[model samples]
Target: MSTRRYPHSSVSPEEFHKWLSTLICVLNSVYFVLNMITLQKLGLGTMQLAVATFAGFCLYKSSNGFYRPWHSYALLISLTINILLSIAVMDLVAGATYWGLALPFWYYSLFGLRKGFIFSAIIVLSAAMVIFFRTDTQVFMPYRTIFNFTLVYCSIWLVCHIYEVQRQKTSEFLHSLALQDDLTNLKNRHALKADFQAFQHSFESMHMLIIDIDHFKNINDKYGHDIGDSVLIKVADALMQSIHTKEIYRLGGEEFVILFKNINDKEAFRQAEKVRKAVELGIFFSHNEPIKLTVSIGISSLRPEHEFTDFLRAADQKLYQAKREGRNRVCA
Candidate 1:
């Protein structure tokens, strides 16, 4: 099944979960202590207290370590349990049942737009059922109470939904600005560094090729900066079309890099050569005149001992070698 995408944040969802989990644990501890000290005055029983303690422990446990995608599932299960407990205690407890009101915010915050909405609906329906039966004990008349509760809860959900949707869009926009080149709309160095760090531990091997435009300064000097920008955009389009499995980065100025995953040196060289030829033969127009350009590429394969910086340095050294040997060529 397809899922809705949420806003991108510099702070990852896992980090958010961890921090929120800690917050929940703290709040649960406070509630647990209050219940114990108050001696059943708030209508909290041993079972409710036990569940609160367990939930606190689980949330605290889930907050530590690298983010596992399944962590949210555990959180969701914990929340479901809490909702059920809240409903079970509603008839006995006067003010305690209102814990269900917080469910909408928690659901939408943790799960994003679509799944969060479904979970929120379930909690609301479950709470409504309990309130429907227990209306005699409630202060307000039955229908009025239900109506007000439903209206207020739905309004809160709607506000949270709109806020989250906007937050998601903002996140996506920020993420794009952070990782993407403004000129070519390709991945930038920051994205490359982030991916390299994430992969360096597990990946056995990787290939990199650094492509530099030949006489790039001369092109800008003769044709002005407008044509130079156009050249970069067209070259980016060509690279995007030529590569399938690899990612392309415009690593500032007229330099670009392509990262090839799990590829051999010979295959990497072939790919680099293909990119060089594609750019060389690719046509560009400047003021109705043809503008021709070529790129020099340097290729490197990852070594077990090499860090990202070392691997990048090796590729950059080779790129300079290609430029030194001749203008449009590949060097390894």
Candidate 2:
């Protein structure tokens, strides 16, 4: 799977929580008002309706606070209140269809699908036995009441499943896009930054190398941009084949970076030199023809107290210095 950028798509779990919380508020508010008004008009009983109404109001308040760190206790208390209230007006004959249906969706949102299904199955079956089976009055139905109930319940479940799948797919796609480089099929810089930060905190010694393809603009100028792109891809492929896949990235234009974690200065420098020689010695094929090319590499490592980017900057400066000395070499 690969990630591609699209507007309004967020990959982070924190962002998703905000969206889900807001959506829950909107849905509960609209349904709560309509259900409260309709249930009161039905003359099911006022005390039960009053309690349910109060619970709905509380749910509206607590669920709407998106900034509050998610704790199951607050939501669980509200859900218990709502469930108890739902039981108050429960009946087989024309109680509240939406009220029953809302619980499954609420469960789905909070606890994930399998758990949601289990909880929903328990709630609905309890309602059927204690409320539906026990009541003499008949619930509203089409020509065939049993058939209609099955159809409606199945449809509701299917819709919930579809929403869950779509959300999961969109989120997965968004994540892939954020981490990948479209041009070279390597990780993008943002992903590189995060990786560097993680490695920085976890490891006392981390090595960073910045590799820039020599005279890339000249290649683009001599050949077409497409051939130049092919050259970049070849260089990236060489790096991938020569080193660990997880550590490589295409940092924009002809520049690529690698971070070797838990490796000391000597081994890291050795690895970078190996990659630099491999890239320099390799013959790149652009349009089925061999083209000679080389890459300049600068290697640096994190000091006891240095920002992650600073360590990389040392390598970057050395890479330019390599160009000054001559294009096809490694500098550390």
Candidate 3:
């Protein structure tokens, strides 16, 4: 909704899914062929064929732009099952046990921290159990096998876990940077659009107030840009204190927007008037010298057929009307 691209990867998620699905299909198909020709393991080859078919289907859907959440889930689950089954039927040494070690990375990348942890834990524990119980004691000591397998599995899991945690933190930090106003420390226009999308379907009635500082250029021209920035910061602080709702955003230099959900026209205007009065009366300082400021607010109500840009345009038109009539009043 925010339109923030993934900071860490060049490829989109859909593209990544398609690529991964294709790789899975190809690798499984190769494995299936090898099992049939070289290994002569009928059951194992059949299972590989089944997994390859499923992965191929997933790839087909993704390439046609029909991907879903369950596609990833189903693929991962099937792969895990096939790996576990191979180890169970063929024993630890002969059966693709090494494949199990990569499960944690796959799970963490696809499912994220919590679900990844649960899924990885289940696979690791299940594999450990199979090795501990079914491993041939004459060829390999059960405890030693279990110990080596688990130690390696845990080390991989820990690395995946740490990487996922850091990835999440970096993502959150980048998202905030994308949506936040650097100067005023308020939500920016991108954030406002994102919030509008979230509220549009859930609320039957919503209102927007677009507030502009009157003759903002005059302040910058008279006192300088630094002083003007200080005034803007003070105004932002005033709006934060005066508005009961937390849906305030700065729509770039000298303009701000506030959103109200499930509110009627009358209450919306009342809230806008209150904000205007607060800004008018509040003391703003530049180098400890008091400066006076006023904001003109324009109000618009959400219409069912209106998209975010349309909604914003309507309020912006009202804002222009307010500016034409006078500089310090509310217009609807």
**RMSD in angstroms, all models?**
4.3, 5.6, 2.3
Candidate 3 wrongly placed segments (more than 4 Å): 1-13
TM-score ranking from best candidate downward: 3, 1, 2
lDDT of 1 at 121: 86
lDDT of 3 by residue, 99-184 (tens): 89989988877777898899989998899888777755577777887788889999999999999889888887778888989899
- Residue-level lDDT of model 2, residues 177-241, one tens digit each, is 78888888888888887777666788767878899888889889988999998888888888889
Candidate 2: regions farther than 4 A off = 1-77, 88-94, 110-126, 129-133, 136-151
- Give TM-scores for every candidate, taking all chains together and pairing residue i with residue i: 0.80, 0.73, 0.93
Per-model CA lDDT versus the true structure: 0.76, 0.66, 0.87
lDDT of 1: 0.76
Clash number for model 3? 0
After TM-score superposition, the amount by which residue 155's alpha carbon in candidate 2 deviates from its true location, in angstroms, is: 1.7
What's the lDDT for candidate 2? 0.66
lDDT of 2 at 145: 44
For each candidate, how many residue pairs have backbone atoms clashing (under 3 Å)? 1, 3, 0
